[model samples]
Target: MGLFALLNRLFHHGPAWLTFLVMGLAAAGLALCSFNLLFLFQANYHLLFTYGAMAAFDGGLLQFIELTAWGYLAIACYVVAEGCLEGLLTRIRRAQL
Candidate 1:
């Protein structure tokens, strides 16, 4: 469906394409960042390669030890919070319907 339709479904329906999409993207972001940080760690500290498995989420020269795993937790929280928010929105919309 189109973007507008998709958004509508997200704000309207409880769980469907939109919810699944959120979950999928969230998972991807988690996996991507996890390995990206791993790459940064190895590259800077140990001078190793991560087989480019982190290209998607790699922050390039923005690597640091502070936000390594925290980023993953943040993404996961966002996904769950978003899913719940969308679910609440759906309930509200359905009630109005």
Candidate 2:
């Protein structure tokens, strides 16, 4: 897809660690929002990041951290696969020349 290509180009030159950092931040932000909404129905309230971090750290809030890890692993695998495929295609084209 065009969007995929665009994103790949944008990130291709950066350190992979940056991508993971951004992903974690994004997940934390979403968790914070989710926690705030979920807390509305309960009598208890906690600090925003505290509740959000619980989603990633605590065993009771939710397993969002595990889910995020899985998602990141999947994306890493895809990038490796794509890179291998591109390399193969380049080799094949060179052979045909």
Best by lDDT: 1
Candidate 2 per-residue C-alpha lDDT over 15-82 given as tens digits, one digit per residue, 9 for 90 to 100: 45555554455455545444444344242234324566654355434444444554555556555445
Cα RMSD (Å) between model 2 and the true structure?
12.4
Relative to the true structure, how large is the alpha-carbon lDDT of every model?
Answer: 0.58, 0.49
lDDT of 1 by residue, 1-97 (tens): 6965655666456465556667667666666656566555666443224433364246533454455555757566466547646676667777898
Error of 1 at 20 (Å): 1.1
TM-score of every model? Answer: 0.36, 0.40
Q: How much is the lDDT of residue 66 in candidate 2?
A: 44
Clashing pairs in 2: none
Q: All candidates: CA RMSD in angstroms?
A: 8.9, 12.4
- Model 2 residue 50 lDDT score: 55
> On a 0 to 100 scale, what is the lDDT of residue 84 in model 2?
41
Where does model 1 exceed 4 Å of error? 1-13, 46-62, 65-74, 77-97
Give per-residue lDDT, candidate 2, residue 39. 43
Q: For candidate 1, give the lDDT.
A: 0.58
